[model samples]
Structure formats: structure tokens, C-alpha cells
Target: MSLLRILVRVALVALLSMAPLSVAAHEVQPAISDVELSEDTVTITLTTAIEPILAGVDLEGIEDTNDSPLSDRVDALRALPPETLAAELAERWPEIAERITLRAGDTRVTPVLVDVTIPEVGDTEIRRDSTLLLTAPLPDDGSPVTFGWDAELGGLIVRQGDDAQGYNAFLTSGAVTDPMPRTGVAEQNLGDVIVTYVVSGFDHIIPKGLDHILFVLGLFFYSLAWRPLLWQVSAFTVAHTATLALATLGIVQPTMWIVEALIAASIVWVGVENIWSGGRRDIGWGRIAVVFGFGLLHGLGFASVLSEFGLGQYFIASLISFNVGVEIGQLTVIAAAFLLLGLPFGSKPWYRRAVAIPGSLVIAAIASYWVLNRIGWAGDIPYLA
Candidate 1:
């Protein structure tokens, strides 16, 4: 077989390896926890979609519950009535409680389940949140407290103290919070806030934002030439940054479904252009304009995730840091593509035919599936739904 044929087979195998993740369209969101400290007791009210936990879905490094082996169980649990689900959770509380961690200094404390409040099931497609109320006795030595849970429970956002003051942090799976005082938790400094948001942003792209990853890869496969790629990436960065700020500030509000559908379509557009452009290194202004427009859609996607982290008092700093992280992620993707494909094979005479075109076809095919899936056209399909 020829080199192009062998490369094509390798590409197909790689695509097949990613088939498991393609249907994982529904994102597993982070749970929000509010920690209140009293003289002798500490109370935590956590609101999260309890179905995945009840269904035994392993949430560590999982972007969507549908990616779990127990996804069907999660679906069934999601359809349960509020009271029924609450009862199931109560029955499972013994095992679940053991996974919770409430520490005062070096001493671990057991937290008792005080109550659970489950809401009426709305759209089954949308995650239904249930609130878990837990209380634990504080140590008498006046030691600071920390909170965390098993990494399999996924990411968490903790808000300690009142609305005006306290510590706010997004903890990754299996991670612990900084020591929080019993009363009047100090507000996080601006420097710390920047670091936190930046990591969150980068995490979204590297691990969680698979759709965005494919889109960036699509851009990378377009050409090996640096100038054209630079122009397109620069346009994309500027446009998305503007819209991320606008959407986050509530200045521009667009329907989420439309934004998502358009984002998938944008990926399809770029992938198709890579093949149709016929190995042209000089891109026109129209290409840059199209990329800029698509960047606006992608920014809205970022805003949706950042909104979950809640900016608190460091809104401006957090937003800028998050954007910086996103740029870093995009640059990382570009760099990897250059190292793997461009550096080794870019100078080869048949590189476009063997690599770029075949890769673009794969990207286009996957994104076309996403477009159909997002718009509800292919929802009935079993695995790729």
C-alpha cells in the first residue's frame, strides 16, 4: 500500500478511538456548595445533580455522564420523581457520607445528613439539581476548617461566608480547599483570584471542552504556513475576547441553542475550507472575517462555563485571566499540531493530499455529526446521539 493509504488507515483508527466521546454531548456540571460556620457547628448546603452519583457514574476526568458505563442508569434515575429520588439518596447516604471530607486542621470530622431537597423534575435533558444539607461539629481548639469530597464526585465550587465577603474557590476533583477560618473568611486577594480563574479556563479547553478542541484542531489542519494561520488565529482571538466580555457582562444575550449549533457549523466551515482551498497558503480577508465571526460564538461558549465559576469581587481580573488561559490553551493546541504534523511532514510534497486533506475530512465529518446532533436532527441515534 502507498504511504497515503497507510496514513489514512491510522487516521481512521484514531477517529474510531474517539467514538466513545463523540456522543457525550451533555456536559456534567460542577456542584455548588455553600459552607457556613457557627460557634460549634459547620453546615454545608450543596446543590448538584444527584443522579450521576446515585447511578454510580465515575465523574473523575469525565466531561459528561453519558460517557459513563452507567449512563442508562443515570437516565432512569433522572426520570424519577423528586420524593422517590430523595428516598433513594437517603438509602445510599451511608456510603456517600464516607466520601465527604470535613477537616478542622488535621482532625477529620464526620458530617451528618440533615436534609435533602429535590426539585420537581423539569426537562429530563436538563440536569435537575438536588440540595444536600450536611452538618458537622466544629473542633473546640478553634482550628480552621477545610472541605472536599471524592474525586469521582467531580468538580466543586465552594462559597464560604455571606454574599458580601468570604472565600470563593473552584476545587477540582479530589482537591481540598485552603484552610477557612470559622468566622469571617478573608476575601481572596486579586493575585490568587487571577491564578484560580486562569487554571479554570485552561482546564476547560484541555480536558472538558472537547468541541472547542476539535474546532481548534480544525483551524490547525487548514495550513502549515505560519502567516495565514497567524492572521486567522489573531482575528479569532480578538473577536472572541470582545464577545466573551459582552456576554458575561449581560450586554449581549443570544439563545444558547443557536449559539451551540452555530459553533458546530463554524467547525464544519473551517474543515471544509481546508480541503476546498486547494493548498493555498495565502488566505483572503474573507477567511479572517469568517473566523472572527465564529470566534464570537465560541466566546459565548466560554462565558457559559465561566459563569458557573462566579467571579465574585474580582470580576475584571478573573475574566481577563480566564481569557488569557483560553489563549494559552489555543496556542498549546497549535504548538502540538506543529510538532506532530507540521515539523515532521509539512515539507513533504504529498503532505496536503496525505495528511491535511484526510485530516480535514475527518474533522469535517465529526463536526457535521455534532451539527446534526446539536440541532436535534440525530438525537434518536443510539451511540452517536
Candidate 2:
């Protein structure tokens, strides 16, 4: 069985690592680029001079304000035509032009996924910023070589030849700068990094950070008993918190792969040890100390999201809110799990075998895959950093 497991792991690693033959062949010629086949989603960013608008809106309870129902506001906004939105903006145009502008039309007036992030930038007064994420599937066989977009969207659309390209454009007071070209990378935001960080951090909790979700779930599963669960959670919290703080302060730059690998390992060790090892009383604090150390690594892994968002300005507030948002996501997961899995199913025989074992196996296998994949022992193409 041991040999079989080892072989399976080895083979899986090889498969994951194997370079796609087509990609390998074309990787060097004419400086091959990543061709985005479709606009899985397009993000539109709007910038404005925030200090003045801060008066029309409240900043202190920004998150709390969102709690009120916005269905009516959404409907009203969505009902307005692009022209109406432009006219409405015309009223605020002078100040809007003074602060910031959009290359694309800002008047979606639609109930799109809009995020407003407020943070104080350097030497500048505290202000508000907004980000809009727009995702629309692409048409069949149509590629975008070059394209232009109208401000009142459904109005002006531009296109070039048959190259499927996605664009990120920034509209300022005077000219439209192709941020895509400026960054030489697709969709890299040069907005108020602080706002971007907060928006990204919040988005990650629900949408992008799947690994973090699994790790938190693994923690919740071990001894779902409140006391034991609380102990582990607290330990994990303290450790990650310490590391997150340190990493934000520039004390660490550990590779994300290692952090992830260790995170998986931590889950496996805790769960496997829980199932077989007799009593914690027998093990000294030395073992506990080891976990704390690993937790520190995990913390930095968590902070990777925020750090990638950039420390620009308002690092402190952004850091605290991001951490709070993460904790909220974590607690929400546990709360939902307990409601669904614990209350009705905790005592049943099938629950333990069905839920616990399968859960652990999945987590272990995933971690093992990540470890092998990261170590490059898998036969996969090397990606440029």
C-alpha cells in the first residue's frame, strides 16, 4: 500500500508537470504571448477626485451602509439610459474632471458588481474610490485584434482584425492611456493601491481564494467540538496574525508555494494525529510550538492577497479591514458548516465516515499534489516569474 501510494503520487506529479507540447513548440518563436481566447470578464475602472464626493457619501460606516437594501437604487440606476447618466455626471463633471476620469463610459447605471473603497492616500486628504467588475462571455470564433469602446457602452464599439485581445483602458481628464500597454501586462491596476487592495481582499474571500477556503474548512472539521476547535482556531489565528503583520512590514517574502504546501501539511498533520494519537496530555508543548511556527508561515500566505494588492497608502487601515474581512469569511464558513453538517448530522454514524474521512483524503491529496507540483518534480513546463 505504501509503495502504491508513492507511485501514484509520483505519477500524478509527472502528469501535472508535463509541458503541453503545442505550447512548448511555440513558446520561443516570435515571443509568443498569452492569447486570451475570450473576454471571460472585463473589468472597468473609474477614477474620481474623492475628497469632494466624500461629503455626499459617508465614509465611516462604509461597509455598514451597504447593509441597507439597494434593490430600489439598483433598479433606478439600471433604468436610466447612458445619456441620462452622462448628463447626471455632467452636473458633477467639473469636479469629476478635476479629480479623475474614465477612458470607458462610467455610467453603467447598472446593477453590476460595483465596489467602493475609501482610503487616505499620502499627503492627500481621505477620499473614496470605485471599481467595477464586468464579466460577459465572448462570441464564437470572434477574436479582438484591436478594439475601441464607447463611453455609453451599448453605443460605441470598436474592433480591428481577428486577434482575440482583451483591453484594460484608463480614462483620465485628457487622454485614454492603455493601461494594458502601460503595464505591458493585462489588467494591472495603477489606481489608489489602497483602494485596490481592499477591493481585491474582499473579492478574494468569496471569489478567488479557493485554497484559503479549503484550509479554513480543514481547521473547522478537526474536532468540530467547540473547545478543541477554538483552541486550534486561536492558535492558527495568533500564528497567522503574527506572520501577516511581519510580512506586511517587509520582514518576510516566502514563496507562496511553500506557504500553501505547509498549510496543507498542517491540516493533514492535525487531522491524522487527531484520529490516531491518544491524548494531547501525553505530548509536550514542543509539538504545539511546531504548529505555531507553521501557522506563522500560513499567515504570510494569507497576507499574499493584500500584499499583491500593494501597500501604497492606508496600509494600516487596509491591513486591519482585510484581516477583519478574512475573519468574517472564515467565521461565516464555520457557521454555515455547523448549521448544515453539525446540528443535523453530527451524531450519525454515516456522518463521521462520509464527511470526515473523505474530507481529510481530499485535503491530503490536494496538498500532496501542490507540494509535488511546486517542487517541480512533476513533469510540467516551467513558468516565467
Candidate 3:
């Protein structure tokens, strides 16, 4: 544990120096990702990283495919009118509606795709696997053009063309998510969103994330003693577990803005407390109480996650398992922290000042900075390419 703690400390110092804010944001969502497509088809394909919640159901192109060449796609598209091309593809795959049109202020579009993929998991991509042979006359409009007439699809319609970089341009990395709810769970096409939400949400509360990791570390930093450390961990477990259940079950809610603010605040509290205080403060149960309170806020945050998912089929099992999963992930983090710092302390008096104090201060500083940035009080934190 002591040696691992040393390595963790070393890594944190190195990463923070390289690109603290940008790397931190990337922990939640990639700022920008690339996708590749052929130059001919009005169809789109995605090649990028997406949070796991989108892996299922949210397809970018076709669900299955072949090593079809880009040229094959181009030649097929050029030979057919746009309507015939859309209809034939719809006949084969069926995800696309025959006619979809909408006005977005001035822009209107219709969508057609040859395939879809979630590359973040395993370099997934959907390519144009076959040609769309239409027995109708081609429109001489010069490009894959869309009309101003309204039609059916998503609330709006759009497509890929030359101005979009190419006829075979990289489409958006986002999957077709359900409409955002105005109040309770909004009805969503949960072909896979449910499982994805649970899995990725679990992953989010783990290693690649520095802020929450630091918060978990803060929970352990105060105890240079074995018994107190045990008690604190137990209390934290109970509190987080209670809230995770309440939130997942839809028993609570906190505005998205406040939940993030408090998360930042929780980190600050643990870090600052670790630095200045130690060895059995007069208020013995104070830390436990504070953690319990923060756990409530975290629970509300958790509920929002499940609520947004809009899936009710596996509610009971998913709620329980997801809560258990969160606890396991949290404990794993604390275990790693102990391996790094615990053995070195071994109930030593000086260990508090030398390691715990300094470490806690650093964590607090980072959390406080996050709070400032989130509230828009500071300039946008510089991110990486």
C-alpha cells in the first residue's frame, strides 16, 4: 500500500502539471473526436469515443457490415436519385424513415445511413457495404439535395453533403438519444440506453476521474490511526449507500447546477479538513455527519442519472446492482489510497504532518478551483486537443 501510494502521488503531480483542467473535463466527455467516412454517399458513419451509455441502441450507421471500399459507396450514390437511394436503403435496414424533412430556422435535412458503430469500445464503424441500385430517373440538381417540405423523422431533419466536408462526411459522435424530459423520466428509445447509463455512470465514479478520486482520498487522509480509519470508512459506506438507493429509486432530486457545486464543495471540505486538523478532534462525530449530508446530495445526482435513462423494465435489479457497483468502485479507490499512504503512517504521530497534511491541502486547492471554474467566475479552463 505504501509503495502504491508513492506511485499515486508521483502520477498526480505529473498529470496536474501537464494539463490539469483539460484532462479533468475529458474524464466526463471527449471535447472533440474524429470519425471517418467515404466521399460519395449521403450516408454517415461515426468513428469516435462516446460514453458507454450510448454504446447500445444509439447506432451511428449500420449495425453490421463488410470491408466495402469507399469507391463502391460513391459510385452507387451517384447512380441514383436521392429519393430512390433513401427508399431502397430504408427497405434494407428500416431505421431510416422514407421521407424526413424539417426547417431549422433556414436549414432543412433528411437522414440516411449505410451503417452505425460505437468505436470507443472496440474501434467500431459502419461502412457502405453495398450499392443502392434505383430503377428510377436521377435528379440533375448537381448534388445530394434536400427539399423545404416538412416530413417525418426526429423533430427535425438533416443530412450529410459536400458542405458538410463531403458526401461521405464524418457525422456527429452523439447517438440518437431520447428527448430530454421536462419533469419526470422522459420516454426514450431505450434499445440500449438503460444498460449503457448504468455501466458508464459506474465507470465515471472511478480512476480516470481525479476530483472524485481526491474526494475519496480525503475520506481517508485524516486517520493516521487504525480504529478511527475503520470507523470513518464504515460511516462513509453507510451514508453513500443510503443515498445511492434513494437517488436510483427516484425518491429525490437536486438541480443539476447545485449537485455539481456541492460535489466540488465536498472535495474542498475533506481536503481542507485533512490539512489543518488531525488526531481526534473534540467533535468526534462531525466528519460522519458531514459526509452523510453530502451523500444525500450525491444521491440526488445519482437519481438524475437513472431518471434521464428513462427505462423502467429492470428498475429494481438495476438500482440495487448499480448501488453495489458504486460502493465497490469507491472501496477500490480507498484501498489503493491505503496501499500508498497507510503503511507509511502506521499510527505514527509525525506521519500526520508529513504526508496527510500536505496531501489534503493539495486536494482541497484543486477542488476549490473546480468550484470557481464551474460557476463561470473564472475564465474557461484551458483544455487539451
lDDT of each residue in 1-385, candidate 3, tens digit only:
5774576567445423322542234322211111112222233232222221111222223211121233344334435544564455456433323232311223333344444332122111212222222111222332322221111111111222221121111112423323212122223233343344445456546633455566677777777566666666677667666776666555555577677778778888988877666555333678778777776666665555444333244455455655655666677776766665566453565656656777777777777877776565545445411
Question: Over 4 Å off in model 2, which ranges?
Answer: 1-199, 277-291, 380-385
Candidates' lDDT values, in order?
A: 0.81, 0.44, 0.46
The model with the greater lDDT, 1 or 3, is: 1
RMSD of each: 3.5, 19.2, 15.2
Model 3 lowest lDDT segment of ten: 148-157
- The top-ranked prediction according to TM-score is 1
Candidate 2 structure quality by residue, lDDT tens digits, 13-49: 3422222211111111000112122333234333332
Alpha-carbon TM-score of each model against the true structure = 0.83, 0.47, 0.52
Superposed Cα deviation of residue 177, candidate 2 (Å): 13
lDDT of 1 by residue, 1-385 (tens): 7875586557544532343335354468789998998768899999999999999888888777876889889888989998899889989988998898889989999888889999887546557788999999987988888899999998899988653345788887688888888877846778889998888888877766767777787777777888788888999999999999998888898898888888989988998998988377788988889999999999999988766676776778888999999999888877876776777778889778887888777777878887887788766777664
